[model samples]
Target: MSLRVAYGARRLFVYLVALVTFGAASPALAKEFHVLAFGDSLTAGYGLPRGQGFAPQLEDALRRNGVRAHVTDAGVSGNTVGQGRARLKWTLDGLKKKPDLAIVALGGNDMLRGLPPAQTRADMDAILAEFKRREIPVLVAGMLAPPNLGPRFGAEFNSIFPDVARKYGAALYPFFLANVAGVRALNLPDGVHPNFQGIKRMVSGILPSVTQALNAVEA
Candidate 1:
């Protein structure tokens, strides 16, 4: 082959090789992680603006802590664990990218509806199992049943989350409403859901746990 032709062919080969390398490294090259905030009205930011929801606020908090992550709000108002499981696949399909970490903040609606504790646990177990099967790290956000639900019911409902976390080796954020539970200023007129300020407190209280969950994913 002529010298000029040989030089041109060699340069083309090098370009092709570089392009292939870049393609192979693309996934790891993307530094931002995705966190799917999967839950009920609490995660959905019921009665609040889209930008002020728990997911966005939590995303902001994550950024402040030097973690590059986008929190996808997957909350549906008045959803029970059964409902969440029924719609889980549809929700996953809607995501542009599968989440690296998922905060499973559900079951409160089940408690409110007086669903069987065993049923609630079973549904949650299935959800957690699905996440594990997909190799997605999960942080189970627990909820305490109202005292009016009876002591036995409260204990059973609250125990489901921690038990599932332990079984699946997932992170646990006990009591999703920890800081704003009885705080009158934090709740809305219903006394169940938190108001705007209460939501901020909720985000702050759960930030550490969510951060820890993200660290697990990084590890």
Candidate 2:
């Protein structure tokens, strides 16, 4: 072959190699993790404007923390643990792909409705079991029962989340509403769902656990 042609071929091969190497190492080429924020109105960003809800805020936070993630809000307002378990399949089917990690944040509505804690625990177990069967990692966002519910009820209800999470070997974010639960300024007028800032607080409180879960998924 002519020297000119040989030199050109060598340069082309080197350029192609560089391109492949860059693609392998580039953040833009990294896997986009899928996270399902499956819960009730809290995850749905009830009373908050677009982009201010838990899912979007969490997604933005993850990106800021140098993680590429698409958080899907599978939350339904007023959804109980039983309802969430029942609709788990439908929600998963609607997703374009199976979630790499799922944040199960139900049972709040069940507590509010004065449902039996045993029932809540069972449904939560079912939900986590489904995710396990699909081989998806999970982070259980717990909910605390109000004092008005009485000590007996509170004891049973509050234990539901941690118990289920332990049983499934899932990561647990002890309380979803950690710092903003009853704060007047953080909550909406109804005092049930969080406002914009409240959602931010929730995302902040759970961000570390989420990052840990994402790391596990990548691993």
Candidate 3:
């Protein structure tokens, strides 16, 4: 072949190689991120259909927003912060792969039970410490106590989540059931948990925080 044609072909090959290399290094390159939604019945979907739970809905929302993530539901009904701490290791051990992000949605049951705020915080701290030790990014979802629980108890109980998140540098979703909490129509018959419509609203409110947590993991 002519030297001119040979040199031109070589240049083309080099350019293609460089392009491929850059593309591989680009952050925009899609990556599959695994997220574990760890919490109580709220995360588990409770009385709703299997597909209608918070994890499934959140996964759909994440995908819709172009995040390549699989959100695993690790919720157990009636799990308090203490119970969550106890089972955390087993839960993590059972995962096929370590999750890039974990969302802690506990404390609802703790609040309902009128558990001591200090004990609840301690349990949460332990949970957060474990995640931090494993270098797993966490997004803590806070739960508020009912007003009937009294202002002093409510304030102390409600502050546990944010305090822990602040201490551990985890992301905080100020209130997991923000838009759905007080709305009578959104709750189940028991009025303590969310119904289908309530779950949707909760998912929507938490999406931004979840997305932020995902970004932290990627970063």
Candidate 4:
């Protein structure tokens, strides 16, 4: 209880508090971020080999760009937007912790099956709403209805991703397929699934948005 002793103790406590605060806020000291790739076959790597899927490839890409991330593949082949919404809670429950960032990439199958655009929009809205309710940051990996789907249907289906993303205040990567879609060489024989090269291209295109989303999560 001497004056000098009390003063030293106070200073030490302040120093410790500052250290703890900095450690918590410093990105360099942060734990690995968990990212959920919540989508369908394109996100699932349907025809590709192990480690070549969107989730794994994206994880590797994030690391290469200096962000520590573990991407979980919640993608299932043949999943429509409605199916994705149905399984959303189950998939989230399976994770050890809630994802730091979620990439919503569903609806391709819905378009392929010729489902109504309104149904697709509703399913997407519910999915994004759940994420928002949980306070999870999202990067919507949008899917564009093919030109063959007819102009009106394509317009309506295509509008769902951006509109939902805006409503949820989420980041949008306009088209998940981007450079790889419709390229015969980049697709598998079935022409719906991406090949190894296609996966790489997709990863490259989306890496920037993923990084931005992680930055927001950290912030």
| Leading candidate by lDDT | 2
Task: List the pairs of residues colliding in candidate 4.
Answer: none
Error of 3 at 112 (Å): 0.7
Error of 1 at 55 (Å): 0.5
Give one digit per residue, the lDDT tens place, for model 3 in 52-108.
899999899899998878999999999999999999999999999999999999999
- Candidate 2 has a TM-score of 0.88
Q: Provide the lowest-lDDT 10-residue window in model 3.
A: 23-32
- The 0-to-1 C-alpha lDDT of every candidate, in the order given, reads 0.90, 0.92, 0.91, 0.91
Across residues 1-219, which tens digit of lDDT does each residue of candidate 2 receive?
Answer: 999999999999999999899977886448899999999999998988888999999999999988999999999999999999999998998889889999999988998899988999899999999999989999999999879899999999999888889998999999998989889999999988899989999999999999999887776
Q: Write the per-residue lDDT of candidate 4 for residues 1-219, one digit (tens) a residue.
A: 999999999999999999899977785646799999999888898987888899999999998878888999999999998999999988887789889999998988998899999999999999999999888899999988888879999899999999999999999999999998889999999888899999999999999999988988777
Clashes of 4: 0
Q: After superposition, how far is residue 36 of candidate 2 from its true place, in Å?
A: 0.4
Q: Cα RMSD for candidate 4? A: 5.2
lDDT of 1 by residue, 1-219 (tens): 999999999999999999999988766546798999999999999988768889999999888887788999999999999999999888888889999999999988898889999999999999999999888899988998888989999889889999999999999988999979889999888888888898899999989988787767766
Which residue pairs does candidate 2 place in steric collision?
none
Q: Give the winner by TM-score: 2 or 4.
A: 2
Better of 1 and 3 by lDDT: 3
Clashes of 2: 0
Per-model root-mean-square deviation over C-alphas:
6.7, 3.7, 3.3, 5.2
